[model samples]
Target chain A: MKYIIIASLSSLILQSYLTTILKIDTIFYPLFLIVNLIVLYKYFNKDNLKFIIYALTMGFISETISSNTIFLQPILFLLISFIVIYISNRIEVGNINLFLIVPFIITIYRILSYFILNNIVHISITNQLLYQSIYSSIVINILYAYTLNYIFKFISNKYKFSMYD
Target chain B: MKKIKVNPRYLILSILIIIVVILSFISYAIKSGRQLSPVESLIKDTVLTTQKILMAPVNFVSNSFKEYQEKQDVYKKYKELQKKESLFDLQEAKLKEQQTQIEKLNELLTLEKTLSDYTYQHAQTLNRNLNYWNNEISIDKGTSNGIEVDMAVITNQGLIGKVVSVSTFTSRVRLLTSSDIHNKVSVKIKTDKEDIYGILSSYDKENNVLIIEGISSNKIIEKDSVVVTTGMGSIFPSGVLVGKVESYELDNFGLAYIVKVTPTVDYDDITHVTVLKRLK
Candidate 1:
């Protein structure tokens, strides 16, 4: 419940800043995608699938408010969350090295999502900003995920928040 | 009473499915011109009002920065204008005489009857779409302010687009740059010989130009000739400036000549526009 509240608030702030302040959402899409996934990963439990659904629902609400498309982001977020969960289950528990592959995973997700939206909805997703978002997100999120993982680990250790350590 | 136990995964999946289905239906219905439900209207009003409040301070700071820059450049611009003041006066007088002559000719031809009288209502842009597919902007005026869908929107320079949807407090303007086939506008090309008519078709996203299609090949169109709305359709007023011709070419099918035009209004710099209401 606490993690859900914090993540929801963070989602709102990130969305507000993206739409209202920068006024350009696609330019920083990779960062948004990765950050949401990281939050879900940090707190997800297989038995309690409600956490994944809650995070996606929060993302859907934010994207619907801030973006032009109504159904694209939420569905895409749900799909990506399942992929991440499936991959993480196979990997060693609390393996930090898995973070290194996140950028590449995000890029693939971006392309697949773009393609799906373009073909299914007949939307024009050919903006150069889409490509820029993919490349920049990959480069930026690698560093971003590392920093976030460090902070989460430090906090977890100090507070003894979970059984990971 | 018997207690019912619900599985969490099944419950969450069902909820997700319900949300997506309801949202999709509402979105489609709204696009199809159904009146908004009271709840939807309230949500829209609250969100738009909040956006307006948050944007106010940011707009003030940016406007102040721009004002300072303008103040710094004013003296230099004034000095340059002083040199051309006499030349402009002479040209203005000549243009006034020509306008009188054109008006007299228009009266003779009874063309004034076809020209609609337009009342302009200025509106501020609240937000712009960040996607490539939908070239739209939300303005801070709506039905309460007398703005209606299909009303033409223009800047000081020329036409920007037309209103597509309206709420009680805000309206959406679909820009001319959108590649949708339904966005075509009937436009006339002003040339030395005579005016030629064509439909303003899809905008070229890569070249940043407007495409005027279905023009006859026999008409000799000069480069840089002006294009303006022909007013054939009831939606847009006639004689509104659209753009100037860039180049003419034979399309791949060779059915009709295609003329590329550069629009008059700078899409990048547009902040405010006037929604035109035709006086009956």
Candidate 2:
């Protein structure tokens, strides 16, 4: 419940309000996707599945509500969360190796989600898939690897999972 | 031997996934022109109301910064506007005279009112869509504010899009930049010779221009020709500005001309819009 409340409030602030004020929401990457992935990576565990599920859904509610159809973001985010959990179990966080691995996972996820939405709903030309994925990957590399963590930590302590250690 | 038992957490996760998948399909299948449920409208209105509160401080600071920037050159712009204002006054008089003349002529001919007869409602954009794939946006107007689905939405610059979904206190608009095949606009390109009509079909995202395809006329079209909604489909009101023609070329078999038009509205940064509701 605590995590869901925090996640919902921050999602509204970051995804809806701040991006509009800064005017970087367009011609740039989806910031919410990167943020959700990082949050899941930092705190993935077996104890509380509801936190992970609701965190992704509430954080991504802006997408689902604004879309003509619902549940695309939750469906995509849930599938990705499961895979991230599987990966998190085997990996050690002390090595900072996720800096290298997360972007790659995100890129594949981006392409797959874009493919699904394009085929199922957006229905534009198939040619834009490659271009959009490449563009998102570059933006994600810069944003996730460097700055968003600090900006996120400023907003809430939920990302305070491993900052001190 | 110990029994191989799956953790109940995984079981819960799997069940949740299956439920969401079923919901996704149901939503997608029946997504065509359905009214929002009471729960959906309640959630949407709550978010929109909060966004309005959050945007207040942001808008204030941004406006202050803008005011400071404009203050430096205020006098220069004031002089420039003074010169233009006199010219505009003359044109305003002519326009009003022509409008009254048009009203008299229409009354004589017993013709019904048209594109000019629309009533507009102002609404502020609460938030943009979370992804770039769909150029949909949520506005602060809905059925409670007399906004309906399929009503044409526009900014001061030109036509932006049409309302797609409406709840009690919030509505969603799908911008013209959306890549959906069904998102076509009938547009009229005014040239020196005559106005040519075509369907505004695809969007050229790379170049930031809209492609108006399916024009059957071979008549030569000039560059920078004005484009507006033809109002033929009845969804969009007539004469709403769409864009200006940038260039044109023949298709592979030369059957029709594909014209590229630059949209007037910056789809990236929309703050407010007006919904044109034709009075019944």
Candidate 3:
């Protein structure tokens, strides 16, 4: 719980200030996707009530600060996060499997947001929506091979808790 | 078939989902263009205030670095500026003359309002989460600064966007590039022969251009012709630069010309903006 709070708060700060400080264009990075996947990974096979509550919290923060729309962010995060966790649990989430799972979650979320924000509400998002999803997922998936892989290795070694291949 | 198992929890969940769906529509309808409730204001003000303070040190460091970079080419830049100074003086004088002439014409025509009549407040950009793409930016000035919804946001270069929502101390400016169907700017393209009018309908993010559609005329729009707001809808003040024409094409239905415009302001690196408030 503490780690999730720290991670999300830090990510929020990063999302707010990182571009200005570093002078980087945000078109290339999938900030939301990276954070969503991190939370989803942590929630997998955990306490269901806690997971659902966290999903709601994620939705609230997004809506209050960034999205400024009601229900949509929360609803999408709840549904998608639930499915991602359920699938990962059933599939025995592996580093190899993550390449498939992460992209699927991202694409679905983008498509749904396109329908809601663009079609239903007219808060239009353009083709760059899909473009960002594709490229960001690819970049993240590659980075996961090093960072997530190392973290899992470290955890299994120190805690005697193994991650299935 | 054996009795299909039914989860009582699923029944309760389905009811809750239906209730939430209905509530969403009700809340959304109530929230549009409405004053922020105290809770909403508190949340937004706190978050935006924190972001503003945090950004201060970051901006100071960034500006210092920029100043250092600028100092390196001071001699070369000084020579360039010296040569440009006389031309700029000439242009400034010409602009002032034109401004007075326009003001006299407005009086002669008995017009109530003109573009130059608006007052502007400088605002610093803060708490902008780029994850949503080029949709919106939060500015430091808000209702307290007399900023309101639909006010025009501009930089020194040109028009950037209009304010969509405002809180007590912070407001969000929806960029011209937003895919929102209602995000249209009435623009004018003046050429040698005539003033071509069109609506800037949408932004092409991939190419970094704005598409001005519904131009019924076939008169060739020259490349790099300046586009500016006509203020026909009164949402934006007239004569604010939108962009320059890059390319044009015939629509699929063979009805109108669709001209592509390259926006003058760089949306990527926007730090400060001026929000224009029309004077009564």
Candidate 4:
């Protein structure tokens, strides 16, 4: 639990640096959620309730940080995170292909969100910035997954298994 | 006989996830129907502020460098003036022509002040993207400094480009040389006084040149003729120096001319630009 908090804070700091210092556009929310899940998976013996809560929390925070509509973010996060945890639990953890599912889900959400926002709300996504953001997020996700797997392995080796590590 | 039971936890988790996803979609639909909240405006302001803070040092350094370059030019001019003094009266007359050019520039500055009421924020260019794909540059000012989208960006030499995106502290200016197919400029031939409309076709990589196509072949255009903005679509102010014609040749159609131009602003050494406040 302490490790997850530390990792979340570190992710925020890294995101701030990437955005301000490096002048690179990157989404830190997905990374924050992924880190928390990895920590939960390694420390605790896969409690579905806790996993659902974590996913929901992650979804809420990610949406909030991304400046998505407030009321919708928590609801969306809870839903997506729950689905991810359910599907993830059914699959073998060692399979790298399972990681691709996160970004795939995010892409679907983004596309759907775009349509919903445009058609219903009348909020348009300018083509240029949208393309740039999507491209940047994809690259960030790929890097995050690679680094996350190693971090999870290290935590699993170092810490004694507990209900809430 | 002991029977294996299904994990109720998995079923509950799956159900919860499905519920959340459904709610999220519903929320998205509802949020889309409503007007944007003040929170979004606040976030935009915060992001712009952050961008401005990051861009300050970069702008300062570029501006200082530009000042140094201008000083060097003045010193070079001084030396040339001294040399002309030692020559015959004819050389002195050439120096007077240079003086008249400066006076003419001063008059244009006065005219600029009278015609436009928009306040301009001056910025220095730190970096420019000259790649075949994107023609953009990082300027020293952003939204925090009142720079906004559709703002006309210009240098002392002529019109540079328009502001595309603004962060809090930094902004991206799309250059006239951008390879994006949608970039179109209404240009006028300074010599013939005729309109030549076209898109920025390509950049001459080997020669560091820009190509402007879709010109009428029948027009008596020549190399070294000046090109300025026509202010047709009102994207830019008229009379902003765009470039000078470098080359012109008939395309296969023989109906329009393929004109190549060298941009007036040394895009390679762009340091400062003035953002026009009120863009019509």
Model 3, backbone clash pairs (residues 3+ apart or across chains), number: 0
* Cα DockQ of the candidate 4 complex: 0.08
Candidate 3 vs candidate 4, DockQ winner: 3
Q: After superposition, how far is residue B174 of candidate 1 from its true place, in Å?
A: 1.9
Ranked by TM-score from best down, the candidates are: 2, 3, 1, 4
Tens-digit lDDT string for candidate 3 (A17-70): 544433334433435434444334543345676676777777666666654665
Residues B1-280, candidate 1: write the lDDT tens digits.
9989999999999998986675565345334534444554555556666767766787799889989999999999999999999699899999999989988998999875555568899988765543333367767798899989889999989999998777788777888987555688999999998999999987776677999999988888999999999877788898999999999998898768999999998675557889998765
Clashes of 2: 0
Models 1 onward score TM values of: 0.74, 0.83, 0.81, 0.46
CA shift at A53, candidate 2, in angstroms?
A: 3.4
The reply for model 1, stretches above 4 Å from the true place, is A1-70, A84-113, A124-165, B1-37, B91-116, B130-134, B265-270
Q: What would the per-residue lDDT of candidate 2 be over residues A51-147, giving only the tens digit for each residue?
A: 4666466534654465545555666677776676666677753226656655656665677666665655545644554556545445544454445
lDDT of 4 by residue, B1-280 (tens): 9998879999899988975776566556333422224554354345334444665676579669989989879978998888877775886789999978866986978654422335689986544331111246656687779988777899899877887666665666777665444456777766756555664556564455677777777778867988877665556666678788898888898898888888887654456689987633
Q: Which stretches of candidate 2 lie over 4 Å from their true place?
A: A1-4, A24-30, A40-45, A93-95, A125-165, B1-33, B131-134
Question: How far does residue B74 in candidate 4 sit from its true spot (Å)?
Answer: 20
Which residue pairs does candidate 4 place in steric collision? A1-A165, A79-B20, A79-B21, A121-B32, B48-B168, B49-B168, B51-B169, B52-B168, B52-B169, B125-B271
Q: Which candidate is the best by TM-score?
A: 2
Evaluate model 2: give its lDDT: 0.71
